[model samples]
Target: MNALFPALRTRTDLPALRFGAETLTYEDLGRAAGALVTPILGAGRVAVWATPTAATAVGVVAALLAGVPAIPINPRTGERELAHILGDSMPGAVLAGADDVLPAGLADVPRIDVETAVDHHSPVSAASAFSGAEPDDPESPALIVYTSGTTGPPKGVVLSHRAIAASLDALEEAWAWTEDDVLVHALPLFHVHGLILGILGPLRRGGSVRHLGAFSVEGVARELGAGGGTMLFGVPTMYHRIADALGDDPALVRALGGARLLVSGSAALPVHDHERITAATGRTVIERYGMTETLMNTGVPVGSRPRPGSVGLPLRDVELRLVEEDGTELRAYDGESVGEIQVKGPNLFTAYLNRPDATAAAFDGDWFRTGDMAVREPDGYVRIVGRKATDLIKSGGYKIGAGEIENALLEHPAVLEAAVTGAPDPDLGERIVAWVVPADAEKPPTAGELADHVAGLLAPHKRPRTVHFLRALPRNDMGKLLKKALPEALHG
Candidate 1:
């Protein structure tokens, strides 16, 4: 019912967005976004070329202002995946930068160059031109974000304006976010972590954001060390690189130490990297948990002591519970029992676009089945073990989480990267297997030594029965491990 970005209404000289060397003041952004409302309005849905550019932000904001659902397409998407998304969403037109050369998939679609649409000469009041025209229905579809399609074809997750508003407000409470803060990140613009939280979150708080365009240690140091940024958001891979460079680059440590908050999401942050970063910089990298379907479910509250390997507590107004395989709820939170996480909250997707069956199957009454397995401590801290399908391993009459094994493997001095999964086993029902990237190529750690290392840290039963060496583990654009893409020869 209310405006999503209140800052766009009033004209101000304050910097609203900085992408690389280009900076857009609040007034400049409001005028550019406002000028394109007429072209974007009445379009059923628009596809945005979500590149890390200021034009992409202007296009998405223009679509939102016109009350049309915007579908963001990743620029680096493969031809097949790009075709699938375009065919599924079927947008009326594509909004992209003027200089962008679209692929064959988007060639037939009408294109609106956002850069040329700006009317800098005319003073178009955003308050009167956009938000003041009419109040939007809270249930109206605002965004149609697609899933990763690891299991099947990517399904479009339809998120409502109410859900987005609820998510940002809850995060404001959890992080103590305000207008004075300047956020910084280099995350991609396709997923919720970067698009919803990184971009729109700052807009909602009337704050500023400085995007690195591409992630680099020097960029981070330059921005934060110069006192231009107060907060930082990154994925585990980015933080791992930061930890690796902290010792060599004192400037990097100083910049990170000066930041008010450093947040990591999209994948689990290993405790080894966490300790390494903290030892160098006094700031702790806070971890939060969420999915494409759910904007944000839990985060560590601001001003609280950071807990390694834990995703703090359930966010404000979010009801989270663990459930057994039989669908019964588990109430005991002694921190050892692992179960699938089910959640009920305002910050949830309306449905999978054009898939009624999937929409129905995803929810049990008001709660959504997340398919993530986690253990909850008595104090309400949530430590995600793994996915229900890939991360949970049934071995020797015990349920073992692959994430725990992976975390323990990362602690070894010889292991550079690790991913844990299960293979069919006759004796143990399912044997835990560790796929490792060794720090040393010529003299890698022996399988027996790595297994013993894990057994000493965790229980003996949780130790990997097989260890496969690799130069590098498979990862997606967001640095999330792709367990399904692991070598099949090792399993055979």
Candidate 2:
């Protein structure tokens, strides 16, 4: 069960990854990992702050080999959030970017220069006998993924190695990935998608991966069209961007000529955009469903007709159920009965880090009640209708999560506060209406500008159809935005 890297390292040497101009074979990458492990030679944790580059990947694997949990820090995360995570996790050491400063309270902790570590020879000290001890007990914390909370605070979900591995195994089995496959790695490594599916999934199957610093539609299209990779994973936004970038370009279409699968997750893929992408790239978007707590649960099978607005069937090891408001179980009918999605499997997380109450309240017995609301078709395929609470917006057969949209909107400089909610629309099932509190209320960013901002950041379907300015959002005594009052603007 242990010695994952050591077991994989035994395989034949082959080109494992291609990033920028650097090509790292499995043997070379494994040796680099061995070298990096020498810096933090103990069982604790280490934070990685970089994109999904070959060196970063090697450092992460090295930390794991040394029995050190790798905490991937989001490069875009504010300093305050970084400091909070570092203080909370209290890792033994940090492998950070050359220019990125250490968190305030973490100045006392050991910080190994990653470039120096990479330059050193692969240490043979711990390679003889790596720690077989489980860094992440079934109940103990392995990885801490921060999710935005109602109070703007972040909650870290602590998952175990078994849990994450189970999810990756399920994904590998479901997607039918093999060593012959080449995955285009564009998602941020800090997120579950990049860390698990982009890196671990491919590595586990001995498949090759091509890492990108960030998702660039043109870059991806050029790579795919040039026969650079076979498989591509991205959110709906990235796919739409690709579609836009490849508009009427016969060259781009020919570039993705040999790709077998194009995956879309993180958020729902708009039905229109899905069709547009298929028409543009000659590839059907294989949509899937999962969150931070659970790595992967369902995916549209390869070579199968992707059901419109449906995330497709659950994985072999996964179990899914729908329940009414009274906790009444609902079966798959014609895919119209909306209910809360409950899942139970080896892939599910152990618990929320240091939040027993949240963990206990999140489940219905052994099943983890995913806060998402969905309906299952007669064939057992699931279509996410909306979120159970907090963040839910359904538009034109697409169920978009608000958290993802808000995260995108905040990326703009002029945006100070942004909230997305479903506004009733006669044409498109539901139109996304964004209420934003601008940085300067008097000279707020124009609706057209804000729309363009989101358009650049998000997919066509996810962009707010209407932008409404607000002095301040409606908040309760706790200062949490009351989403319940959000619908009034549209209905009135």
Alpha-carbon lDDT of model 2: 0.71
lDDT tens digits, residue span 1-492, model 2: 233443344543676777778777666666566556657766377777655566567667666666667777776677687777777777788776455565565576677655422322444323333445325354345577776454455677777777777777777777787788888858777768877778777777788888776677666766776746889888766765666666766776766656878888877665656776777766788889998887788888877875757888888689988887688998757666677889998878877666788889989999888878887788888887667775566688875667556656766768766777777799887888888878787788887787777778777788888888776667532123567766564354
Give the RMSD in angstroms, all C-alphas superposed, for model 1. Answer: 1.6
TM-scores, each model vs. reference: 0.97, 0.77
| Location of the lowest summed lDDT over 10 successive residues in candidate 1 | 127-136
Candidate 1 structure, TM-score to reference: 0.97
In model 1, residue pairs whose N, Cα or C atoms come closer than 3 Å (at least 3 residues apart or on different chains), thus clashing, are: none
lDDT of 1 by residue, 1-492 (tens): 137988876535788889987888877788887777888786789999999888888888888878889999999888999999989999999999989989998998889888734456686756656854433588898899999998789999999888999999999999999998899999999889998999999988989999999999899898888946899999999999999999999988999999999999989999999999989998888999999898999999888886889888889889999999999998878888999999989999999999999999999889999999999998989999999999999999999999999999999999999999999999999999999989997889999999999999999999999989987888889999889888853344
lDDT (C-alpha, whole model) for all candidates: 0.89, 0.71
Candidate 2, residue 382: the lDDT equals 86
Q: Which stretches of candidate 2 lie over 4 Å from their true place?
A: 1-3, 97-105, 115-141, 150-152, 390-492
